[model samples]
Target: MSTITLSSAARARATGRHFVPRLSWLWSGLFGCLVILNIAPLIWGILTSFKGQADLFRFPPAFVSFTPTLENYERVFLSGFGGNLGISLVNALAAVVLALVLGLPAAYAFDRFNFPLRRLLFLAVVASIPLSIGAAALLIPNYVYFASLGLTNTPIVLPMLYAAHQLPMAIWVIKGTIEGIPRELDEAATADGCTTFQILRYVILPLVRPALGAAAILVFVGSWNEFVASSVMVDSPSLRTVQPAIYSFIGFFGREWGPLTASATLAILPILIIFALFGRLMVSGLTKGSVKG
Candidate 1:
């Protein structure tokens, strides 16, 4: 094609882009549907908190409240649900920390070394992805084993479970992040008489801090929301986490909506806030991992 014709075609495409009504409508329609789907449940949950359980069960179901009250929120928050949420938070935090401690070094090794069985082991780890090994199936063995180990029905079990469950993906994430760093950097550091640990501390870790932060959040959030393992492993009252509390709420005598709603709201707020703050870094880490080998 001639340069003039190519330029004219480009200009015409640009002009056409300015008035692409069908494209605009398509995007708007899709966006609207997605927004509604995402927001509706959240809005419904919030609205449900304001209404009494009886109000929620009304024949037609009240979409709009004539007499919204704080009862459900009160029940959720003021009750022991707050304590349960606190337990979940602590469990998540402990799990993420444990994962980082184990995963970072493992990731570094996998990224930097030429050890035997590395690829095989990594593939084995990846293979666990599709396998459903939830606590229900493992319950009998877990009880017997943890009973012998004496870690059963304790808060200590939470971190261990969280880390164990998240260890594979966490290691994968950090290892992938580490692999992106130039190998030349390690050699450069070694030439300067730096030890492997020092190189990791000063070089690799600093460069991959964003990925680490994102991993920490992701690991913690997953653990915090983990219901099955916690429910099966910890039957002690104080050890119970938030999701179990929600389950307990359903069985409680008399309808208490206020505190229940408040607890749910509280449970949601921290994660939402953390994501809102670190969303950019998380996106960047994921993109960086995805685009790399």
Candidate 2:
């Protein structure tokens, strides 16, 4: 009886070991398919951007090899797209900077301080996430106000709108990140006579580096991709952003597909580049507090 029991236990261990590899293979293939599915459209856009307009309507779509041309790129540059690209860059960067300046301290306050209506205010921040009010909804009022003030088509309006739009989300995200950090560290700093701002600038900020990076990326991307707001806020050619500028490829007669796709490819390039460079920071921020102190 003992020998039979030992034999069964050994078999069970072996079976479990064998099952893990099969399960891992199954999950690997499933996630591989998912990754490929997500990346396919982006790959197609890049390929289409390279193809000439004649190849666009070809019977069998060329996935591998096709004659590529730079005419679309040339057209994009010659049509004042460079100026729009610069506007987008400036707007995104400025919005992110403004958001961090305003939102980070608010997040820290929410996380560390006890105040009246704290829960209610935090809830409001969270609730803003589901609010679907778009730029069109506020366009008439903003247009009237800005026009009255003679601020229409100014360089500052779009960035300010982007910062306002992204502020609540930034506060909520950073507050959550701050909550994950141990309060004991704050107490320790207090015991050492560190001022509130010093603790924030020295200890809290360094620990929350990942969250700041994530918020910056989110705000930047949101500002960069915003079209309706940019279109409504600034109609001046000099103040237009990349996304609205892409519409120049369309005309009353016909849409220029090649230049449109090329511009789209260019619009998405900065986002991809930003992630490629700093994605690890976001990952680190998420995992930094995972292990117990």
Candidate 3:
């Protein structure tokens, strides 16, 4: 009986070890499939950007045999896409700076102070996140308001709107990060004769750097990618942003796929470079801010 029991136990252990490896393989295969699904389109777009116009319509699509040309990129730049790219960069950077400037102080206040209606105000901020960013219903009203104020068609309009759109979320992110910090630090700073602003600058800012970085990246991306509002807000060709400029490739007759893809490839470079450099910091900040300490 003892010998039989020992053999059964050994068989169970063997089965468990085999099952674990099979499960790991299954998960890894699924993960690989997801990665391919997300990355394949981006890879294809880059390849298409390099292909000649003739290769674009070729049967079976030339994955590797096509002779690459810079003509498409040249056309894109000569068509004022370069100017649009510059406009987008400036607007996005401006939005990032504005959102961070306004959001950090509000977030700090929300986390540290207990003013009247503070909870209600924070709740409104949270509610505004989805309403302002996700909903298109506000577009017409915002355009009308801007038009009334003569803010439309100005270079600063889009950046201001983008900053406003991102501010609520930025405040939320920074507030979460601040909550994770201990009040003891603020008290210690106060003991060291730090004023409210000084404590926020010297203590909170350093600790919440990750959250700030995340907020900046978010605001930049949002402003950079914004199209509908930008298209409606500005009328001048010189003031047009990257997305609306990309949309110009869709003419009344047909699409300019080559230049479109080329411009798109160029448009994504800044974002990719940002991610490559600060991707870890953004991810760490998000993770830290999400879970309170």
Candidate 4:
């Protein structure tokens, strides 16, 4: 009886080990499929960008073995997509820099100082979430106001609006990061005869650098992808940003699918590159700031 029981236990243990490997493989394959599904559209767009106009409307869509051409890419350059991209870059960069400069000091002040209406002020700052405004809602007001200012078709308007929109979120993230710093460090710096500016420049800034990078990345991306504000506020060919420039491919006659896709591919490249470079810092900063010690 004892020998029979021992044999049964050994069989059960062996079965469990085999089952675990099977389950893991099953789950891994399912997740892989999900990732592929999510990425398929992007892959299709990229492939379509390389196809000639004739290939684009082919009866049976071919994922491969299509004749590739540079006609779309050439048209993109010839249409002055380069100038539109430069306007977008300038607007996004300027907005990010201005938001950071304005938000950082305000965040430090909120964390370190006690002042009148502090809670109310903090709440006000918290209310400014990025991307909160709907395009339809903003379109009329922005058009009317900027048109009145004689700035409707200028490059300056979008950057200014982008900075205003980003400021609240920037303040919120930076303030949270500043709060994570030890009060003892600020005291230590003071004891060492560090002035307020000096302490902030040397101590606080370095410690919160990751959060700054993370916040800046968020702001920059938001500003870059801004469409409604840029689209409705400015109609000048040279001053248009990437989104409008991409839309130009679609007209009354027909959609220029090849150049449309090609321009889109070019537009999103900057965002992907920025994330690849700063993704680790963004993740680290967000994680560290979420937990208060």
Top-lDDT candidate index = 3
TM-score of 1: 0.85
User: Per-residue lDDT for 74-159 in model 2, tens only?
Assistant: 98999999989998999989999999999889999998999999999988887775322345666788779878988878988888
lDDT of 4 by residue, 1-293 (tens): 99999999999999999999999999999999999998898889889999997899998998897998989999999999999999999999999999989988899999999999988998887865734333456668767887889987877888888888888878888888888888999999999999999988999899888888888998888888888888788888988999999989999999989999999999999999999999998887776677776
Clashes of each: 16, 0, 0, 0
Segments in model 1 whose C-alpha atoms lie over 4 Å from true places: 1-21, 129-140, 252-262, 290-293
Task: Tell how far residue 191 is off in model 1, in angstroms.
Answer: 0.7
- Ranked by lDDT from best down, the candidates are 3, 4, 2, 1
Candidate 3, residues 1-293, lDDT tens digits: the string is: 99999999999999999999999999999999999999999999999999898999999989989999998999999999989999999999999999999999999999899999999999999988863454467889999899999999999899899999889989988888999999999999899999999999999999999999988998888788888798899979989999999889989989988998999999999999999999998888788867676
What C-alpha lDDT values do all the predictions have? 0.78, 0.85, 0.91, 0.87
Best candidate per TM-score, number? 3
lDDT of 2 at 34: 100
Error of 3 at 270 (Å): 0.9
lDDT of 3: 0.91
Better of 3 and 4 by lDDT: 3
RMSD of each: 3.9, 2.9, 1.6, 3.0
